[model samples]
Structure formats: structure tokens, C-alpha cells
Target chain A: MAMPFEARYRVYWHHTDGAGIAHFSRILAIVEQAEEDFYASKGLLHVHGRLPRREVYASFLYPLRRGDEVLVRIWADEVRRRAVRYRFEILNLTAGRKAAEGHVVAVCVDSEGGELKAVECPQEFVEAWKEA
Target chain B: MAMPFEARYRVYWHHTDGAGIAHFSRILAIVEQAEEDFYASKGLLHVHGRLPRREVYASFLYPLRRGDEVLVRIWADEVRRRAVRYRFEILNLTAGRKAAEGHVVAVCVDSEGGELKAVECPQEFVEAWKEA
Candidate 1:
């Protein structure tokens, strides 16, 4: 298993509720942002990608209360011929508790309607993530 | 118990995932929108409300699969001295299944941080929702 890349963020007002805790939806937003950042860090800029070459699916496991400084740890769980699995775990850094955990599955295609051949994890990308 | 107001919406691309189903967070988004619509339907514009008079809290009960045409039914469960409870139910209109259910709890407070007195459900508001 590879060590997940960690992203830190503060609980902002817009991300919280009247009770002063982060809204549950905002946690999903944070996780999605971290996933995008992970792909962008690997030179896969989703902003320009077309043809639905890759698609992400995710699920929520738990809620993150407001005022909790959290850390999102993410990793590509597996890379296969057509699909890649990414896992996530959100930690309550202050309390050192596992607040949430989930995974996303993405499929790779090509610019055209045809499928891309020979999918392999980039050595540098894998190494960098494993080191993280 | 009163009948809940129902809101219907299509599952757009922005609201779905690779699995072609609506994302969980998007469910929350719809519920929030319906709640706002309920208040606005009764002539209460949240955009202008100040003094921290009322606040809302929500929780998720189940997952809504993508491509699922959903009907979000919302209603005020109760109105007390300082709190209002709103309940929600997501129905799979096609399969005729109860996909999810949850509730939101809101508190009423004054502009200067004082508590509001004698909170009561406006008749027009309650009647409107009941008819809806």
C-alpha cells in the first residue's frame, strides 16, 4: 500500500453551520478538491481533458464537525487496465481521530470514443506518492 | 403530522458521478434548496434576514443513486420556544422506494445575540406547506 498524500485546510465560515461546525457537504468538497489536486500534481490536468477519459465516483463514510482542523489523506489504491481506485481518509488532526474514510473509482478512455491501450502507473508519480 | 412540500428536479451532470448516479452531497444541496424555497414561498426572504434569528442543521440518512429522478419532500416537524425542526424524505419516483430520510434543526436568536421569545409557526406558512 502507498502512503497517502495529505492536505490540510481550515474550517471557514462558508464551510460551517450556525452551530459553528463545518457543514457535512463541505467535507465532500474538500475531498474532491484534494483528489483534483492529486491528479494535477501528476500532470493530468482535468480542466482540459475531454472524451470522459477518466471519471471519479466517491462515497461518504462519516461526518466532520465544525471547528475541527482536518487532514485529508488520499492515495491511488490501485491502477488497472481500465480503472483506477483512489482512497481517502479524513482525520481530526486536533483530536487525532479518524473522522471519515472513502474511495473513488476512475476509468481511463481516449480523446476519441475508442479506449486507451496499455495503462500503466507512471513511475515518478507512484514513487512520489509512495514517499508521501 | 403534516404533509411535506415536494420539489422535483432532474439529475444533471454536475450532480452525478461516473456511475451515472447522483452524488450524496448533491442530495444535501437539493434539500437545502427546497428549504430555502419553502421560506421564500411564504414571503420570507432569507437573503435579507439578519440578527441571526434562525439557523439550520441537517443530516443524511441514506444514499441516492445516480440517474435517479428524486422528489424531495420537506416540512416543519415542530416549532418550539427557540428551535424549529424540519424533516426531509427523498423518494425514488421511478422505483417507488424511500431512498433517504433526514431532518434539520434550527435555532432562533436575536440580533444582539439574545434569544427570540415565543417562537410560533406562522399559520400562513404552515397552511401553505400543508397544502403543498
Candidate 2:
């Protein structure tokens, strides 16, 4: 199992969604931010090819409210020739609980001069994960 | 087959997510907004109680960018005693394509005086849905 990446974020009031709880849609926004952080830290940001999201799954265990802080924890669940699945857990730090659990899969792709095409996992990225 | 609920929305630049395309998560925000519009038109807003989201699934078919115009289409996919699944399609009206498709399942619940508990679907809601 790969070690998960963790980051913290606070809910804001801009979108005082239904009942004041965080909108379910924003959970993945947090997930995506943390995921990008993970890749950036390893210096693989754009040196590696782009990843287009394919699917997303999320299950809410408890509601998250405005001003509530949380930990966005993510890990690579599966890596294959063309896709990588990242699992996520939004841990509510304020209430000390898991707010939600989810996963998102991004398929690897190569783009050059505005042309796009699906590609296999870059060997360096695969090796890096293996060593992680 | 049931007629789907439909509404229009425009992309804003506030959180011009990754690569200038709309954040994958916000597709559901559009979905949720359209869904509430549908319920509100039926005059069922809170008269039947709340619907706490349980599960969400989304698949991206094409990228949606800021300034893009879209149609958020939604409808009930399943109706049970406790859960009603709403399917959504974010149609890129400006680009003439399907930007994304997804579903969110919200379970009926009864909440009174700051307490919450899951409850079966109210008969009135079911009947209204049937008549629609």
C-alpha cells in the first residue's frame, strides 16, 4: 500500500449551501487540490503528462459545515497502463471524525501542440510510486 | 420513461479549476441547483422534510470551461421507501455536447428540533412524482 497524502482545508461561507453544511460537490474539489499537491511535491507536476478524470465516487458519513476544518487524505489505490485511482478520506478535524470517503480515477494522456491522446503510465511515475 | 428536469447555468471564473476547465466536482453543483429548482416548482420544498445525500457518482465525458453555457438536466432514476436517486447530465449547450453525466442519491429523512433520523419516503412525494 502506498502512503497517503494529507492536507488541511477549512470550509468557507461563499457557498452557504443547503442547511449550512458543505455542499457534497465541494468534497472532490478538496480531493483534487490535495492530489495536485502530492504530485507537485514530487516535482512531477507538468513534467509528467496530464491526467483527465474519468470517474468519481463519494460516500458521506457525516455532514461538514462552514468553518469546520478537515484533512484531505488521499492515496493511489490502483495504477495500471492507462489510469490511476486515488482514494480519499475527508477527516473532520474539528469534530474528530471521518466526514466522507471517496475515490477518483484519472486516466493518463499525452498532449502535444494541442493534440491529445491516451497514453500508458510513464515509467518514471510508476517507478516513483513503487519506491514510495 | 419519465421527463427529465432541465435548467440552464453559466460558468464563472471564481475557481477556474484545473486547466481552465470547470472542476469535475462542480458539475454536480449545477446538478444540485437544477434538482432544487425542480422540487421548488412542485412546491415540495421542505413540506415533506429533508433529503440528506447518501451517495454520489459522476462520470466526465468532456471538459467544461469557464464562460461556457450549459443545461443541467436532472430526473429521478429510482424511487424507494427511503431513497430517491437523481440522474443528471450537464449538456454543453454552447459547445453542443455532453459535458458530464452523474447521479446523486438522497435519502428521505425526518428532522425536528435539531435531531435527525432517516425516514421512509412520504406518500405525497411519491404521488407527486408519479403524477409528474
Candidate 3:
């Protein structure tokens, strides 16, 4: 099995809610940042803006407060002709435990001529994941 | 069966992503706004900030772009002693179709004295759902 791409981030006030913990929605954004970094590491920044999420599921295990450091790990769980499913885990380093984990299914689409059409995954993504 | 509470909103540039559609994460925030309004309608604003999400799932069916009007409907799916599962649907009025749908499972917790403890759902929520 290949090692998952990892990224670290610190929770900020804007990422949290009135409950003083990171808002559940922010988890998706954080994992997306890690996904972007993963693609950038492979010199495939262009892969962005094409893969829109089709489905997402997340479970929160531990709460993360503002200023808490988190480690996000992501890897391809499944690859299809026009979609990819990525599994991600977020660890709350301050609490020494898993904060949240989830999977996102993103479908590749082409938005040209004022219409959105499903497209096959880019060659760059296939090659990058293969190399990883 | 009871009718679900509904709220209408317009998608803005800030709510969209590079894909030219609403970012997947923003769906949760938008539904949360509707949830807050539902509570407020029942004079239960205090219910906010107490129920933190334990799990959430969303499936996007159709794309929603900037300036698109959306109608969000939410209702209690299941209610336990210390948790509630709320089902939600986001309809794209511009596209005249279901844009996204999902469920959120939130656990009631008491955050006092700098500690968080699981607690039973408030009586206000019970009454509100009963009325609904």
C-alpha cells in the first residue's frame, strides 16, 4: 500500500463554531487543502477546478479547538473512469487522537461552452496516482 | 408525516468554488442556517451550539451556480436520548431539480466549566419536533 499524502494545519477562530470546536463543515475544506497539496506535489495543480464532489461522508471522533494542530492524511481509495474516491483522516495532534475521518467521491467534469459534461479522469491524475 | 421546515437562499460568489458551483462544504453551512432558523421559530434558539455533529453525509445530484436560488428543507429523522438525526434537502430552484440531500447526526453535549459532557436532548427540542 502506498503512503498517504499528509498535510498539517492549525485550527483558527474562523474554522471553529460557537461550540469552540472546529465546525464540521470545515473538515471538508481542510481535507481539500491536503488534496490540493497532494496534486501540487505531483506537479498536477491543473487537476483542480475539474473534480467536483459527488458525495461525501464524515464522522467526527474527537473535538478540535482553536489553535489545535491537526494532521490530515489522504489517499485514493478508488479510481474510476470519470470519478475518484479519496479517503482522508484528520488527527488532532493536541489530543493525540483521531479527530475526523471521511471519504469524498469527486467526479471529473468539463465545463465548456456554457455546459457541464462528465469527463474521464485526466491523464495527469492517472499518472500521478500510479507514481504515488 | 409532517412537512419539513424550509428556508430559501441565493448562492453568492463566496459560496462557490473554482468549479463555478457551490463548494460541497458550504452545503452543510447552508443547512445549518436552516436548522438554526427552525429552532428559532420554536423559540428554542438556546439549542444552538449544544448539538455538535457526530456524523454527516451529503450526495450532490445537480450543480448549483452563483446567483442560483436554493430552497433548503430540514426535518428530524430520528431522535434519541442524547442525539438527533436531521435529514435535509437542497433544491436548486434555478435548475428546477434536487441539488443535494443529506443527513446530519448531532450529539447533544454540555460544555461547562471548560469540559464537554454528553447530555440528553433538551426538552425544548422534543416539544418543537412534536409540534412539527
| Best candidate according to TM-score | 3
lDDT string for model 1 (A1-132, tens) is 456777887666788665444565667678777766776776755531321223223333323455668888888677664555667788878667776666655444342222223244445544544544
| Residue range with the least summed lDDT across 10 consecutive positions in model 1 chain A | A47-56
Off by over 4 Å in 2: A47-49, A110-116, A128-132, B46-49, B110-115
lDDT of 2 by residue, B1-132 (tens): 568878898988853554566766666777777877787878777642377788999998777777889998887778888878878888988888887888888888776653346788888777555543
Candidate 1, residues B22-64: lDDT per residue as tens digits?
Answer: 5656666787777677777767545213212122233333235
* Candidate structures ordered by TM-score, highest first: 3, 2, 1
lDDT of 2 by residue, A63-114 (tens): 7777889899887787777877778999989878888998898888776543
lDDT of 3 by residue, A1-132 (tens): 577889999999999888888889887799899989999998888887888889999999888899999999988888888888889999999889899999999888898875678899888797666554
Better candidate number, 2 or 3, judged by lDDT: 3
- Identify the CAPRI category of the predicted complex in candidate 2: medium
Candidate 1 global lDDT: 0.57
Q: How would you class the docking of model 1?
A: incorrect
- What DockQ does candidate 3 have relative to the true complex? 0.91
Interface root-mean-square deviation for each candidate? Answer: 11.0, 2.3, 0.7
For model 3, the stretches where C-alpha displacement exceeds 4 angstroms are A130-132, B130-132
Scanning candidate 3 chain B in windows of ten residues, the lowest lDDT window is B123-132
